[model samples]
Target: MPAPERLLPYWTIAVPPLALTVHFLLHSSAGPAAAAVLVAALLGAVLSAVHHAEVVARRVGEPFGAVLLALAVTVIELGLIVSIMFGGQPEPTLLRDTIHATVVLVLHGVAGLCIVVGAIRHREQDFSTRGAQAYLTVLLPMVALTLVLPNFTTSLPGPYYTATQLAFVSASCLVLWLAFTFVQTVRHREYFLPLPATTADEAPSPAAVAPARPPGRQSLAALALLLLALAAVVLLAKDVSPYLQSLVTKAGAPAALVGVIVAAIVLMPEGMTAVRAAKKNQLQTSINLALGSGVASIGLTVPAVSLVAWWTHTPVALGVTPGGAVLLGLSFLMAILTYGNGRASLLSGVVHLILLATWLFLIVVP
Candidate 1:
């Protein structure tokens, strides 16, 4: 087996609580310079969160590790959003904007960055085409049922679904994600595993790469730290939301940009981990991380939000605007072609990045 995992950095142990304290007690009253420091601490927490998560993931194993990290972050984010929604009059379009931004971020930004990083380093990278396809297949339907279908439904006027229709859609997303998880971790586990590199320079031997898991005690420690970091992250992001909204408002940017900022902050750890995996030529693992984040964002967030909205008698919107639908359509179509061949190149990465840029530009111009 490869060398045992590295020692846990001290910052990893300290940043979470520091961020939590700063977010809760001091953030609002801080001056501009202090605010910058707080933002730095926030970013430090994100980096440390990824470090602890990687420790836990290595202790666990491939796709399962990714799933654990994704699910943990999503669950926390879902709780934060729900708590905020229940705290006051919730925005009807909050769920839609957040979910749409997540999908867009993953499909284009995260995946494209991974591809570009890996391809630039190694000329091209290979992953399990089946695995990529599987992610896309499940993602398409979930997006359609939750985002697109609501636009056309007549049971309720506008983009709002009737009670029965909402329940059906939520159930459908949950079921689809569960089935995809089963296939990913159990039935076709190999599909998500990293493909062997053809050259020694590209990848070390399997044993060299798969280091022995940390001892039981270390594993437990890592798990605890992971939870702590994630908890702190959610709180910090929630605190940042109002400030972010204010900035966007001052700039006269679209309201949707606020959701994108929230989603991006929430996803920073996962995106960082995925990009690192790509830099190491571990494209399969990166794809698993990127696509897995997308799948979990919708599959988990929708049902949780739906239940809360239903219980609170809160109105929620699920449908995207025509501009959003076009972006979604283009993103999915590009995903199909990108993963269709099991190979990724610099060109593919650049194309996807352009699409993401188009998305950001449209948000401002449209």
Candidate 2:
């Protein structure tokens, strides 16, 4: 047999199962200590997921690699939302909140952090402008259609689409998603490739990225572990759903915060990976993950959500407040400039971050 790829780290191999075990142990419990353990395990599994995903990404290479990771992460996120929605009381706003949170967090928060970290390390970073443009091209329209259009449509009352409208919107998003995926992975894969860095400073930092995947079994092991990690992450997140609600209530936070927290936890590890890629001067890779996740979150999510909500007779509200619309518009405009510019710097990153902070603050205080 071919030599086994690099032996797997014990933690990467162990965390997912262990987290699942903890989830079973504490899933029904109601208390602080249990919540703490579950949260810790959840985080461990996230890190483990990232490690396995990176290995697979290395094995697969380029935009397809990015697509795999993004799809996996978004699937886990969608699973969490579905499980929670069906497992308990109706949460009509959950889908909207989660999708919105995913877009806002990925587009501004993760992307911003990547630029900041990369710029701080190298002072300048180069990535494929076309790649960024491609992501926004799909993402912007879908956002407007699903998140914004609902508010204005006369076919339904405030903030909803009639079944016909929902069906149309869902189909439209899926088409956009399918077309973008095909383009990114097949027709123009080079758009997502890491551009050749223009300066010596743009080189990968010594510790920025893990070494290449070993040839034989490591990739296979990673693929298996990635699946395991994703399951653990999704289930454990659902198990923690009660705590999120209770925590939000105790804090006197808005109901929407539950979605934000869920999105935050799910995206945190993935965002870290993107930041690391940026620090390595692989800004295109970071962009792929950021925008890819943003697009996939909406494209894949809305369709699945609409179908399920229809079957179960669940209500989904997909409109944003005026403030939310303004923030989203600003965010899109910022994303456009960031992606269109070809060069990334500290200032652009800071701007994106500011938009994120403003959204968060307004949500809390408004």
Candidate 3:
């Protein structure tokens, strides 16, 4: 059994529920200052929950661990998006903007930071090229078909999809995503595994490596906590949305700024974990987390929101603006180059960060 102190982190599991109850009881009359404090507390609780999820991921091991982390974070992202969508008058463009922002954040911002930090520290970090190729192969087309093609299609007036197109496209995305999931978890799992170290010095330290087997009871507890935390986040997100929206509005920020903030909040835990893995020279794990989260955000989120839109008779737009399309294309090209050689350098990181900056700039300027 692990030491008792090692389990101290589990105490955080109670925070989300407590925070949610308190917010519900108090938020109706809470002023802006009080709301701000509540938002901070909620964000902190979410981060703590994310930490617990990371601990669980470590115990689960490899490809599965990455998948678990991706799913956990994606759930948070989807929950927030869904809650906001249903909370008030639906913003037709909100889903599109949020999805676009999420892809950029994960594929560019988070991934870039990880690569830069890893490259600067290790000088060069290597990961499985096959793994990246698999991700891009599915990701590029999905992004193009879902986010880009909608603008060009005559099947729908404006950049919006008709019911038929939405159904078809949503189903296609889900199918493709499911197929990719099977490959990652089953067919070619080895492709995602870390490459063998070339020398003893390159090998991970004993303490840094995962155990041969994780404790079952501990794993179960962690899983329970993860689910509870996610539920709390979703439940509380409805209350948090108004404060987030007001903050952006008061600053005279672009409407898309809301999407960016939501994406950043949802990606925080996964991004930190990925960056830490990169710093440890576990670039493969970092790559998996970054790309996997991006994939899940798009693949899972679009279909989900589509279903909701259909049920509610809400208008859903999936197309990127012309400027967004161009930026998205550039980001795809950058990702291809970044992962092309199975190695990353500071230059690669810089290019991605530049693209991320462009995306953010366009949100405000365009």
Candidate 4:
């Protein structure tokens, strides 16, 4: 078997960053725009990771560090994507569809499988059957008001108004997503709920700690280097957006593709972690991280962009297409199914994968 130490390097350095780089390059358009995005994404991903470490360190007592980190990354990722949308090149409906697509994939597809897998492994794990249902409560209304209604508009003033509607919708999304994060991270924080209670006489599980370093200078040096790398990534993303926009225009891909592409990039790190956790039979953590990240992405990104668009008078689309609405409905329903039971199985995993495929089909097709 491969040594755990060897695997650690992959998580800490190799994989998360490698994915970001490839995403930049593959999506880059030829010329200055491509170069700019490459630089910005690289810098952004690094800074984004550092910000994650800072968030984890600051919010130490939060139930899941990984989930919190995923939220943080989504914020940065959305920040870049939304900023790009402001420049001419992206589809008007890109923001709305992207947010919708991300929520579906993360909450239902990734989260559902995590729960199912966890349950299958532990058998005793609780899926919080009732709590999972809350997804339906929130998601249905969100989809209806924002996505579904737009398709039926018969007398809209113009495409400009459609863009304005998207901005408002983005704002709403940001608020909802962030509110959920606050609740999860700060208010209704996770306790050792599923873990068996320890008797007074029993020893507690030992918390993992870092080994002492030789000097404070080394720590500072590491921090500085990390910050520097992060700056580069953001700068790269700035340029990357134009290239991607050009590619989209050139290829005539659907609006939803932007969301999937961005979400996949944002999700790279947490997705790997979730898969690894499932393999280790740590399904609850995986479920929490994956689902939690999806929720956070919605709550946070929508608001952030909404505020910007409102301020700048840039238009964004908030409506979900009929097709997207159906997928969203199914995705939420599945999330309830996967997490409500507090257990998991390969069956649930397959279900989520199906949902993921459905999303891909929706985005790639006309």
Candidate 5:
């Protein structure tokens, strides 16, 4: 049996159901003040669910842990996107903007923070060059084909892909993502493992060491709870969608802001895990979490959304704006430079962070 302290994370199991009930009972009739309160409550639920996800990840280990976190976040992100996509008023650019924002957030925001913090503490951190190369190999082409190429495609009108192009792009992304998953988890799993400590001083702290997997029952319980918590997040996102739409419309905020917000919310668990790993000089884990989430976001989310668009006969935009395309290209370039040499430094982190900030600034000005 788990300790009392360990069981605390299970509280997330209750959050979603409770939040869902509350939203259904009161959200429609609630005033702005109540809505604000509901939002805060839902946000807390998201954070709590993220905490539970981290606990579960720690029990699983390595590339699998990162993969689990990515899938969980992706599920929540997909729920939010689909909810909004089907919600009031058509926003054709919503999916594209959200995917673009997700890429930027993972590649630059989360990855940059990890690199900066790790480099500042450790001077430099070592990871597998092969792992980084593999990620970029799949990620670069995935982004270019799905996001950039659409802008220039003569077959489509105004960054919009025809049914044939969309089907091809969707299938291509799904296959590439599956190929990368096979390599990461099966064939080349060792590539993502943390480097051995060279000197006595470089040894990982106790907390940094991989924890033993919990017993089978406990692990199963954790998995069940994770699914429940994820379900709650999706339900809560649905409740929040109306408010978000209202706010965006009234405030005249850029549609990209919604994507950024959703990306940040979904990425929270993995982001926390990545930063912690980086701080402990576990750069490989950080890279895995950071880049893996990016890959999954594009690989999985794009296809799911595209299919939904097709089913509903909604006009979907898959291409980036000119400025978005340029920023994404730069982000990809910086990622290569940062991880090209099998090591990371403060400068690399700084470069990526600057790119992230530029992307954020453009949301308002663009």
Candidate 6:
């Protein structure tokens, strides 16, 4: 199909919200399970939009376009999720755990799957194994400390978890996210560097790297837009969440619906990137972006939301439940093994699928 035709298919963005509307009208009330599905579909649409933008950027050979698209989606997705979170009865620690989950999914699962698939398909190791290893090493300890351990103990609020404790966790996650982003930024710089005066191929010089913007201007712009977007999402969520949460509380829906819905909303854009990359044979970059976004989502999104909760004096839950912790640990381990060697195999892909299935099962079973 032509590019024009491809663009038309992206209209699927309309599906998610429409589905939510239909759900609202028909049921006049929906449960968490339904809500979760709706949210996931919505997020998937968002992810698809980002992936499409990246495709256009790739065709045009414009990295800036990709960066802009990523920035836009990141802001939008975070805005929507945070808004919904605040709209509901406050789950302070929820933001932290969700962020942790997103990181785990990205670092170990999505990255591992991409590497494994790409390696197998290309019949060669053509990607960055070291990057994957470094990511997992840092990710595992951080998650174990911040998420898994906290779930089992209730000493979190006053003693083991104080104002300082929360700040440390939130800041640590953000720093980790920044560290990963730095890696990508550095790699992009390296790629754009001068090939040296001795190079034989005569070609026009690649465009000069843009001058750095002042930190103040960038920070102010980010803060303003983020505030604006978050406010908008919060308004929408306030209208939506009470009804949704009530439905769940009243036993009209399953309890596990919350996680599913939250996952869908955040993971939407990511799924789009993955399928598109697989089709394009650019699976490595796709994996990198998908997993990268996931990590960013967990690391960045949680802290930002948690800070909001803190300001509002809401409860924040950063740790996974005992069962959830176990599943997450196993998932992380499998992901590390799959992507550790920088090579992928069909079997590795199957392992990730299995892990996802396990996650779903755990969420659904009481």
Best by TM-score: 3
lDDT of 2 by residue, 1-366 (tens): 332433467888989889888988888887799999988988888888877887788778765776787677766777668876666645678887887898899888999999999989888888888888998989999999988999999977868888888989999999999899889988998888777656676555543444554565688988888898888888887877777677888899888887787688778876887898887778888888788777888888889889988898877899988888888898888888888879999999999889889889987999
Candidate 1 lDDT over residue span 25-130, tens digit each? 8556645665566567667766677677777877788657766766776765674566445444345777888889989999999999999999889888888999
Instruction: Indicate the worst ten consecutive residues by lDDT in candidate 6.
Output: 191-200
The 0-to-1 C-alpha lDDT of every candidate, in the order given, reads 0.80, 0.82, 0.79, 0.57, 0.80, 0.54
Per-residue lDDT of candidate 4, residues 118-234 (tens digit): 556644344344334444444555556565666666547322335556556566766665555556556654431233323433222443122222234433433443444444445
Flag regions of model 3 displaced more than 4 Å. 1-11, 52-68, 206-209
Which ten contiguous residues of candidate 5 have the minimum total lDDT? 1-10
After superposition, candidate 6 runs with Cα above 4 Å error: 1-71, 107-126, 149-160, 187-239, 243-256
Off by over 4 Å in 2: 1-7, 57-67, 199-216
Task: Tally clashes: model 5.
Answer: 0
Per-residue C-alpha lDDT of model 3 across residues 24-55, encoded as one tens digit per residue = 77567557876776677567667866766776
In terms of lDDT, which candidate is strongest?
2
What TM-score does candidate 2 reach?
A: 0.90
lDDT per residue for candidate 5 within 82-187, as digits (tens), equals: 8887877556777887878778988899999999999989999999989988999999898888778887888767688898899899999999988898898889
Which prediction has more favorable lDDT, 1 or 6? 1
Candidate 6, residues 255-324: lDDT per residue as tens digits?
Answer: 4455455554566556556655544345555556666566556566657666776798766666666677
Q: Looking at model 4, how many pairs of residues clash?
A: 37
Question: In candidate 5, how many Å is residue 88 off?
Answer: 0.9
Report, for all candidates in order, the number of backbone clashes.
0, 1, 0, 37, 0, 13
